[model samples]
Target: MSGLREPYGRGADEAGFTLVEMIVALAVFSLLSVLLFHNVKFGVQAWRSGSARADELQRSVVTQELLRRLLGNAYPLIIKQEALQPRIDFEGGSEAVEFLSEAPVVSGGAGRYRFKLFVDRTRQQTDLVMTAAPELASAQDNSASRTLLVSDIDHAELAYFGAPSPGAPGRWNDSWEKQSDVPSLVRLRVSFHASDPRTWPDLVVALRVRADVSCVYDPITARCRGR
Candidate 1:
Protein backbone atom coordinates (compact mmCIF):
# COMPACT_ATOMS: atom_id res chain seq x y z
CA MET A 1 0.00 0.00 0.00
CA SER A 2 2.81 2.54 0.76
CA GLY A 3 4.44 1.85 -2.63
CA LEU A 4 1.17 2.51 -4.48
CA ARG A 5 0.66 5.79 -2.58
CA GLU A 6 4.24 6.93 -3.30
CA PRO A 7 3.98 6.18 -7.04
CA TYR A 8 0.67 8.05 -7.36
CA GLY A 9 2.09 11.05 -5.50
CA ARG A 10 5.11 11.10 -7.84
CA GLY A 11 2.86 10.91 -10.90
CA ALA A 12 0.83 13.86 -9.66
CA ASP A 13 3.96 15.92 -8.93
CA GLU A 14 5.32 15.29 -12.50
CA ALA A 15 2.14 16.56 -14.26
CA GLY A 16 2.63 19.39 -16.89
CA PHE A 17 0.98 22.88 -16.79
CA THR A 18 -2.71 23.08 -17.81
CA LEU A 19 -3.92 24.80 -21.05
CA VAL A 20 -5.12 27.86 -19.03
CA GLU A 21 -1.64 28.31 -17.53
CA MET A 22 0.01 28.28 -20.97
CA ILE A 23 -2.46 30.90 -22.30
CA VAL A 24 -1.90 33.17 -19.26
CA ALA A 25 1.89 32.97 -19.70
CA LEU A 26 1.65 33.84 -23.38
CA ALA A 27 -0.69 36.79 -22.66
CA VAL A 28 1.71 38.23 -20.06
CA PHE A 29 4.66 37.93 -22.44
CA SER A 30 2.75 39.68 -25.25
CA LEU A 31 1.72 42.53 -22.92
CA LEU A 32 5.30 43.04 -21.78
CA SER A 33 6.54 43.07 -25.36
CA VAL A 34 3.97 45.70 -26.35
CA LEU A 35 4.91 47.93 -23.40
CA LEU A 36 8.60 47.76 -24.31
CA PHE A 37 7.85 48.65 -27.93
CA HIS A 38 5.71 51.61 -26.87
CA ASN A 39 8.48 53.01 -24.68
CA VAL A 40 11.08 52.60 -27.43
CA LYS A 41 8.87 54.24 -30.05
CA PHE A 42 8.19 57.23 -27.78
CA GLY A 43 11.90 57.69 -27.14
CA VAL A 44 12.76 57.65 -30.85
CA GLN A 45 10.11 60.23 -31.70
CA ALA A 46 11.33 62.54 -28.95
CA TRP A 47 14.89 62.28 -30.22
CA ARG A 48 13.86 63.18 -33.77
CA SER A 49 11.87 66.19 -32.65
CA GLY A 50 14.78 67.43 -30.56
CA SER A 51 17.19 67.05 -33.45
CA ALA A 52 14.97 68.97 -35.86
CA ARG A 53 14.47 71.84 -33.43
CA ALA A 54 18.19 72.11 -32.81
CA ASP A 55 18.92 72.29 -36.53
CA GLU A 56 16.34 75.00 -37.06
CA LEU A 57 17.71 77.04 -34.16
CA GLN A 58 21.23 76.90 -35.52
CA ARG A 59 20.07 78.02 -38.96
CA SER A 60 18.14 80.95 -37.52
CA VAL A 61 21.17 82.15 -35.58
CA VAL A 62 23.36 82.02 -38.65
CA THR A 63 20.88 83.93 -40.80
CA GLN A 64 20.54 86.63 -38.16
CA GLU A 65 24.30 87.06 -37.91
CA LEU A 66 24.69 87.34 -41.68
CA LEU A 67 22.01 90.00 -41.85
CA ARG A 68 23.51 91.87 -38.90
CA ARG A 69 26.90 92.12 -40.52
CA LEU A 70 25.42 93.46 -43.74
CA LEU A 71 23.33 96.12 -42.01
CA GLY A 72 25.83 97.21 -39.40
CA ASN A 73 28.62 97.87 -41.87
CA ALA A 74 26.56 99.46 -44.60
CA TYR A 75 28.94 101.94 -46.23
CA PRO A 76 28.13 104.92 -48.40
CA LEU A 77 30.77 104.40 -51.05
CA ILE A 78 29.75 106.98 -53.62
CA ILE A 79 30.39 106.47 -57.32
CA LYS A 80 29.12 108.02 -60.52
CA GLN A 81 26.14 105.93 -61.57
CA GLU A 82 25.36 107.61 -64.86
CA ALA A 83 26.40 110.84 -66.63
CA LEU A 84 26.92 113.05 -63.58
CA GLN A 85 24.37 111.72 -61.09
CA PRO A 86 26.09 110.36 -58.01
CA ARG A 87 24.30 107.15 -56.97
CA ILE A 88 23.71 106.15 -53.39
CA ASP A 89 25.29 102.92 -52.25
CA PHE A 90 22.16 101.78 -50.49
CA GLU A 91 18.72 101.45 -52.08
CA GLY A 92 15.91 99.59 -50.27
CA GLY A 93 12.34 98.79 -51.16
CA SER A 94 9.39 96.84 -49.82
CA GLU A 95 10.44 93.59 -51.42
CA ALA A 96 14.06 94.17 -52.30
CA VAL A 97 17.23 95.81 -51.03
CA GLU A 98 20.34 96.71 -52.98
CA PHE A 99 23.52 97.76 -51.31
CA LEU A 100 27.24 98.02 -51.97
CA SER A 101 29.21 96.47 -49.13
CA GLU A 102 32.59 94.98 -48.52
CA ALA A 103 32.65 91.29 -49.25
CA PRO A 104 33.33 88.70 -46.58
CA VAL A 105 37.04 88.16 -46.21
CA VAL A 106 36.58 84.41 -46.19
CA SER A 107 34.92 84.48 -49.61
CA GLY A 108 36.90 85.07 -52.78
CA GLY A 109 35.26 88.49 -53.14
CA ALA A 110 37.89 90.68 -51.47
CA GLY A 111 36.85 94.21 -52.34
CA ARG A 112 33.20 95.23 -52.66
CA TYR A 113 30.15 93.62 -54.21
CA ARG A 114 26.72 94.92 -55.07
CA PHE A 115 24.52 92.70 -52.93
CA LYS A 116 20.85 92.53 -53.66
CA LEU A 117 18.30 90.73 -51.52
CA PHE A 118 15.05 90.03 -53.29
CA VAL A 119 12.18 87.57 -53.38
CA ASP A 120 12.01 85.01 -56.15
CA ARG A 121 8.56 83.58 -56.50
CA THR A 122 7.94 80.32 -58.26
CA ARG A 123 4.97 78.06 -58.80
CA GLN A 124 5.54 76.29 -55.52
CA GLN A 125 6.69 79.03 -53.14
CA THR A 126 8.71 82.19 -52.72
CA ASP A 127 12.36 82.33 -51.78
CA LEU A 128 14.62 85.11 -50.54
CA VAL A 129 17.81 85.26 -52.56
CA MET A 130 20.98 87.29 -52.24
CA THR A 131 22.85 88.09 -55.40
CA ALA A 132 26.26 89.64 -55.55
CA ALA A 133 28.36 91.19 -58.30
CA PRO A 134 31.50 93.26 -58.38
CA GLU A 135 30.69 96.76 -57.26
CA LEU A 136 29.87 98.83 -60.36
CA ALA A 137 31.37 96.14 -62.54
CA SER A 138 28.13 95.84 -64.54
CA ALA A 139 27.62 92.12 -64.65
CA GLN A 140 24.98 91.05 -67.15
CA ASP A 141 22.76 89.27 -64.65
CA ASN A 142 23.41 87.75 -61.21
CA SER A 143 21.47 84.61 -62.08
CA ALA A 144 24.53 82.45 -61.67
CA SER A 145 25.69 84.13 -58.48
CA ARG A 146 22.90 83.81 -55.97
CA THR A 147 22.55 82.67 -52.39
CA LEU A 148 19.35 81.51 -50.80
CA LEU A 149 18.72 83.27 -47.56
CA VAL A 150 15.32 81.76 -46.75
CA SER A 151 13.08 79.45 -48.75
CA ASP A 152 9.43 78.49 -48.92
CA ILE A 153 8.22 81.88 -47.90
CA ASP A 154 4.57 82.74 -48.31
CA HIS A 155 5.20 86.43 -47.82
CA ALA A 156 8.07 88.83 -47.27
CA GLU A 157 8.44 92.58 -46.88
CA LEU A 158 11.12 95.22 -46.25
CA ALA A 159 10.95 98.72 -44.77
CA TYR A 160 13.31 101.62 -44.25
CA PHE A 161 13.37 104.42 -41.69
CA GLY A 162 14.94 107.83 -42.16
CA ALA A 163 14.00 111.33 -41.17
CA PRO A 164 13.22 113.51 -44.20
CA SER A 165 14.05 116.55 -42.12
CA PRO A 166 15.77 116.97 -38.77
CA GLY A 167 13.38 116.77 -35.79
CA ALA A 168 10.68 115.62 -38.22
CA PRO A 169 8.42 112.64 -37.74
CA GLY A 170 10.48 109.61 -38.62
CA ARG A 171 8.39 107.05 -40.48
CA TRP A 172 8.89 103.73 -42.18
CA ASN A 173 8.80 103.79 -45.97
CA ASP A 174 8.44 101.10 -48.57
CA SER A 175 11.23 102.58 -50.65
CA TRP A 176 14.42 104.57 -50.03
CA GLU A 177 16.67 106.09 -52.66
CA LYS A 178 18.36 109.24 -51.41
CA GLN A 179 21.20 108.94 -53.97
CA SER A 180 23.64 110.22 -51.30
CA ASP A 181 22.84 108.41 -48.06
CA VAL A 182 21.58 105.21 -46.48
CA PRO A 183 18.63 104.41 -44.30
CA SER A 184 18.94 104.65 -40.54
CA LEU A 185 17.07 101.37 -40.04
CA VAL A 186 16.18 98.40 -42.22
CA ARG A 187 13.36 96.03 -41.36
CA LEU A 188 12.70 92.61 -42.83
CA ARG A 189 9.58 90.49 -42.42
CA VAL A 190 9.04 86.95 -43.66
CA SER A 191 6.48 84.20 -43.25
CA PHE A 192 6.49 80.66 -44.52
CA HIS A 193 3.71 78.95 -46.43
CA ALA A 194 4.96 75.43 -45.96
CA SER A 195 4.23 73.19 -42.98
CA ASP A 196 7.59 73.80 -41.38
CA PRO A 197 7.17 74.46 -37.67
CA ARG A 198 10.02 76.92 -37.44
CA THR A 199 9.33 80.63 -37.58
CA TRP A 200 11.57 83.62 -38.26
CA PRO A 201 11.32 86.67 -36.08
CA ASP A 202 11.21 90.05 -37.79
CA LEU A 203 14.63 91.67 -38.10
CA VAL A 204 15.15 95.39 -37.47
CA VAL A 205 18.78 96.44 -37.73
CA ALA A 206 20.19 99.94 -37.08
CA LEU A 207 23.13 101.26 -39.04
CA ARG A 208 26.28 102.41 -37.25
CA VAL A 209 26.46 105.45 -39.52
CA ARG A 210 23.33 107.49 -39.21
CA ALA A 211 21.49 108.76 -42.28
CA ASP A 212 22.65 112.23 -43.36
CA VAL A 213 20.48 114.18 -45.78
CA SER A 214 21.89 117.64 -45.14
CA CYS A 215 23.78 119.54 -47.80
CA VAL A 216 27.21 118.13 -48.49
CA TYR A 217 29.04 121.26 -47.27
CA ASP A 218 32.47 121.36 -45.66
CA PRO A 219 32.19 121.45 -41.87
CA ILE A 220 34.77 124.22 -41.44
CA THR A 221 34.48 126.20 -44.65
CA ALA A 222 30.72 125.73 -45.12
CA ARG A 223 31.46 125.85 -48.81
CA CYS A 224 30.58 123.66 -51.80
CA ARG A 225 31.37 120.00 -51.09
CA GLY A 226 33.47 118.20 -53.70
CA ARG A 227 32.28 114.82 -54.88
Candidate 2:
Protein backbone atom coordinates (compact mmCIF):
# COMPACT_ATOMS: atom_id res chain seq x y z
CA MET A 1 0.00 0.00 0.00
CA SER A 2 2.80 2.44 0.81
CA GLY A 3 4.55 1.74 -2.50
CA LEU A 4 1.28 2.20 -4.49
CA ARG A 5 0.48 5.48 -2.69
CA GLU A 6 4.01 6.85 -3.43
CA PRO A 7 3.61 6.03 -7.16
CA TYR A 8 0.17 7.75 -7.22
CA GLY A 9 1.64 10.87 -5.62
CA ARG A 10 4.34 10.98 -8.31
CA GLY A 11 1.73 10.62 -11.02
CA ALA A 12 -0.38 13.47 -9.54
CA ASP A 13 2.67 15.73 -9.53
CA GLU A 14 3.37 14.97 -13.23
CA ALA A 15 -0.29 15.44 -14.33
CA GLY A 16 -1.25 17.46 -17.47
CA PHE A 17 -1.78 21.29 -17.21
CA THR A 18 -5.07 22.53 -15.66
CA LEU A 19 -7.69 24.43 -17.72
CA VAL A 20 -6.96 27.70 -15.90
CA GLU A 21 -3.20 27.42 -16.46
CA MET A 22 -3.63 26.61 -20.14
CA ILE A 23 -6.00 29.56 -20.65
CA VAL A 24 -3.58 31.96 -18.90
CA ALA A 25 -0.67 30.83 -21.09
CA LEU A 26 -2.66 31.20 -24.27
CA ALA A 27 -3.88 34.70 -23.28
CA VAL A 28 -0.31 35.86 -22.58
CA PHE A 29 0.92 34.52 -25.95
CA SER A 30 -1.95 36.21 -27.80
CA LEU A 31 -1.21 39.58 -26.15
CA LEU A 32 2.48 39.34 -27.03
CA SER A 33 1.66 38.45 -30.64
CA VAL A 34 -0.67 41.46 -30.96
CA LEU A 35 2.01 43.81 -29.58
CA LEU A 36 4.68 42.45 -31.94
CA PHE A 37 2.36 42.71 -34.95
CA HIS A 38 1.50 46.36 -34.17
CA ASN A 39 5.20 47.21 -33.76
CA VAL A 40 6.02 45.72 -37.13
CA LYS A 41 3.14 47.57 -38.79
CA PHE A 42 4.23 50.89 -37.30
CA GLY A 43 7.79 50.36 -38.45
CA VAL A 44 6.70 49.61 -42.01
CA GLN A 45 4.57 52.75 -42.22
CA ALA A 46 7.41 54.92 -40.91
CA TRP A 47 9.83 53.50 -43.46
CA ARG A 48 7.44 54.15 -46.33
CA SER A 49 6.79 57.73 -45.31
CA GLY A 50 10.49 58.40 -44.90
CA SER A 51 11.30 56.92 -48.28
CA ALA A 52 8.60 59.03 -49.97
CA ARG A 53 9.92 62.25 -48.45
CA ALA A 54 13.47 61.47 -49.52
CA ASP A 55 12.43 60.77 -53.09
CA GLU A 56 10.53 64.05 -53.27
CA LEU A 57 13.48 66.03 -51.96
CA GLN A 58 15.77 64.42 -54.51
CA ARG A 59 13.42 65.23 -57.38
CA SER A 60 13.04 68.87 -56.30
CA VAL A 61 16.79 69.37 -56.22
CA VAL A 62 17.24 67.87 -59.66
CA THR A 63 14.49 70.02 -61.19
CA GLN A 64 15.93 73.23 -59.72
CA GLU A 65 19.43 72.49 -61.00
CA LEU A 66 18.24 71.81 -64.52
CA LEU A 67 16.07 74.95 -64.59
CA ARG A 68 18.95 77.11 -63.40
CA ARG A 69 21.28 75.84 -66.09
CA LEU A 70 18.76 76.39 -68.89
CA LEU A 71 17.61 79.86 -67.85
CA GLY A 72 21.12 81.11 -67.05
CA ASN A 73 22.30 80.26 -70.57
CA ALA A 74 19.44 81.86 -72.55
CA TYR A 75 20.39 84.17 -75.46
CA PRO A 76 18.59 85.98 -78.24
CA LEU A 77 18.13 84.71 -81.80
CA ILE A 78 16.43 86.23 -84.87
CA ILE A 79 13.01 84.88 -85.83
CA LYS A 80 11.86 84.75 -89.39
CA GLN A 81 8.69 86.77 -89.94
CA GLU A 82 6.65 88.18 -92.81
CA ALA A 83 6.61 91.91 -93.73
CA LEU A 84 3.54 93.30 -91.87
CA GLN A 85 2.51 90.43 -89.57
CA PRO A 86 4.67 89.72 -86.55
CA ARG A 87 4.64 86.21 -85.07
CA ILE A 88 7.00 84.08 -83.04
CA ASP A 89 6.96 80.42 -82.03
CA PHE A 90 7.05 80.06 -78.28
CA GLU A 91 6.55 76.34 -77.65
CA GLY A 92 4.58 73.30 -78.78
CA GLY A 93 5.57 71.92 -82.23
CA SER A 94 6.64 75.39 -83.40
CA GLU A 95 10.21 76.69 -83.73
CA ALA A 96 11.76 77.96 -80.50
CA VAL A 97 14.15 80.73 -79.64
CA GLU A 98 17.69 79.34 -79.82
CA PHE A 99 20.24 80.26 -77.21
CA LEU A 100 23.85 79.14 -77.62
CA SER A 101 26.28 78.84 -74.74
CA GLU A 102 29.19 76.68 -73.65
CA ALA A 103 28.19 73.65 -71.67
CA PRO A 104 28.28 73.92 -67.89
CA VAL A 105 31.54 72.76 -66.27
CA VAL A 106 29.64 69.78 -64.95
CA SER A 107 28.96 68.73 -68.55
CA GLY A 108 32.77 68.53 -69.09
CA GLY A 109 32.58 69.69 -72.70
CA ALA A 110 32.28 72.94 -74.69
CA GLY A 111 29.31 71.64 -76.66
CA ARG A 112 26.39 73.89 -77.63
CA TYR A 113 23.22 73.53 -75.53
CA ARG A 114 19.75 74.19 -76.94
CA PHE A 115 16.75 74.45 -74.62
CA LYS A 116 13.13 74.13 -75.74
CA LEU A 117 9.83 73.45 -74.00
CA PHE A 118 7.23 71.39 -75.81
CA VAL A 119 3.99 69.74 -74.75
CA ASP A 120 3.66 65.98 -75.01
CA ARG A 121 0.01 65.32 -75.74
CA THR A 122 0.40 61.58 -75.38
CA ARG A 123 2.07 61.81 -72.00
CA GLN A 124 0.00 64.80 -70.90
CA GLN A 125 3.23 66.44 -69.84
CA THR A 126 5.62 69.14 -70.96
CA ASP A 127 9.11 68.21 -72.08
CA LEU A 128 12.27 70.27 -72.01
CA VAL A 129 14.64 69.08 -74.72
CA MET A 130 18.37 69.76 -74.70
CA THR A 131 20.74 68.66 -77.43
CA ALA A 132 24.43 69.10 -78.11
CA ALA A 133 25.26 70.73 -81.43
CA PRO A 134 27.06 68.37 -83.79
CA GLU A 135 30.71 68.78 -84.51
CA LEU A 136 31.44 70.36 -87.91
CA ALA A 137 33.25 67.42 -89.43
CA SER A 138 31.26 64.43 -88.17
CA ALA A 139 27.94 66.25 -88.27
CA GLN A 140 25.49 64.52 -90.61
CA ASP A 141 23.42 66.44 -93.09
CA ASN A 142 20.10 64.93 -91.99
CA SER A 143 21.11 64.43 -88.37
CA ALA A 144 19.68 66.81 -85.79
CA SER A 145 22.21 68.48 -83.48
CA ARG A 146 20.15 68.91 -80.31
CA THR A 147 19.95 66.55 -77.32
CA LEU A 148 17.33 66.12 -74.56
CA LEU A 149 18.10 67.79 -71.25
CA VAL A 150 15.14 67.28 -68.91
CA SER A 151 11.57 66.14 -69.58
CA ASP A 152 8.41 64.90 -67.84
CA ILE A 153 6.89 68.23 -66.95
CA ASP A 154 3.25 69.08 -66.27
CA HIS A 155 3.40 72.59 -67.72
CA ALA A 156 5.98 75.32 -68.37
CA GLU A 157 5.27 79.04 -68.76
CA LEU A 158 7.37 82.14 -69.44
CA ALA A 159 6.53 85.62 -68.22
CA TYR A 160 8.41 88.77 -69.12
CA PHE A 161 8.91 91.46 -66.47
CA GLY A 162 10.99 94.55 -66.98
CA ALA A 163 10.81 98.08 -68.39
CA PRO A 164 8.41 97.62 -71.26
CA SER A 165 9.23 99.64 -74.34
CA PRO A 166 7.20 102.86 -74.98
CA GLY A 167 3.84 101.50 -76.15
CA ALA A 168 3.50 98.14 -74.37
CA PRO A 169 1.62 97.67 -71.07
CA GLY A 170 3.03 95.63 -68.19
CA ARG A 171 1.47 92.16 -68.30
CA TRP A 172 2.26 88.50 -68.42
CA ASN A 173 3.08 87.50 -71.96
CA ASP A 174 1.75 84.02 -72.73
CA SER A 175 4.35 83.79 -75.49
CA TRP A 176 7.61 85.72 -75.76
CA GLU A 177 8.08 85.20 -79.47
CA LYS A 178 7.59 88.81 -80.62
CA GLN A 179 10.43 90.32 -78.65
CA SER A 180 13.40 91.00 -80.89
CA ASP A 181 15.77 90.70 -77.94
CA VAL A 182 15.75 88.78 -74.70
CA PRO A 183 14.20 90.65 -71.81
CA SER A 184 16.25 91.90 -68.86
CA LEU A 185 14.56 89.31 -66.68
CA VAL A 186 12.36 86.31 -67.38
CA ARG A 187 10.02 84.68 -64.87
CA LEU A 188 9.71 80.97 -65.47
CA ARG A 189 6.83 79.07 -63.93
CA VAL A 190 6.63 75.29 -64.01
CA SER A 191 4.05 72.87 -62.63
CA PHE A 192 4.15 69.11 -62.44
CA HIS A 193 2.50 66.21 -60.64
CA ALA A 194 4.48 63.50 -58.86
CA SER A 195 3.61 59.84 -58.58
CA ASP A 196 3.62 60.40 -54.86
CA PRO A 197 1.56 63.43 -53.94
CA ARG A 198 3.12 63.89 -50.51
CA THR A 199 6.54 64.33 -52.07
CA TRP A 200 5.79 66.99 -54.65
CA PRO A 201 7.48 70.35 -54.12
CA ASP A 202 5.86 73.71 -54.77
CA LEU A 203 6.26 74.00 -58.54
CA VAL A 204 7.41 77.57 -59.11
CA VAL A 205 10.86 78.71 -60.26
CA ALA A 206 11.80 82.19 -61.55
CA LEU A 207 15.03 82.58 -63.50
CA ARG A 208 16.82 85.59 -64.98
CA VAL A 209 18.09 84.96 -68.49
CA ARG A 210 21.70 85.98 -69.08
CA ALA A 211 22.24 89.08 -71.24
CA ASP A 212 24.55 89.25 -74.22
CA VAL A 213 26.74 92.03 -75.64
CA SER A 214 24.29 92.70 -78.47
CA CYS A 215 21.57 93.76 -76.06
CA VAL A 216 20.29 97.30 -76.60
CA TYR A 217 21.63 100.02 -74.34
CA ASP A 218 19.70 102.83 -72.66
CA PRO A 219 18.71 105.77 -74.86
CA ILE A 220 20.61 108.13 -72.53
CA THR A 221 23.78 106.16 -73.10
CA ALA A 222 23.25 106.32 -76.84
CA ARG A 223 22.72 110.13 -76.70
CA CYS A 224 25.80 110.55 -74.51
CA ARG A 225 27.87 108.53 -76.95
CA GLY A 226 26.57 110.69 -79.83
CA ARG A 227 27.89 113.77 -78.00
- Per-structure clash totals for the candidates: 0, 4
How high is the CA lDDT of each candidate model? 0.76, 0.50
Query: Candidate 2 lDDT, tens digit per residue, 1-227?
Result: 65555656677766978889999999999999999999999999999998977876786677667656665565443333335332221221232334444455555656544444443344455565544443232435544445443356565555555334546766544445455445544555545556624333433334344334343334544321211
Cα deviation at 175, candidate 1, in Å, is: 1.3
Measured by lDDT, the strongest candidate is 1
Task: Report the CA-based lDDT of candidate 1 relative to the real structure.
Answer: 0.76
lDDT of 2 at 185: 47
TM-scores of the models, in the order given: 0.79, 0.59
lDDT of 1 by residue, 36-145 (tens): 99999999999999998998779877988898788777767554433455555687888998886668655675766777889999997789898777654655664336
Of the candidates shown, which would achieve the greatest TM-score relative to the real structure? 1
lDDT of 2 at 208: 47
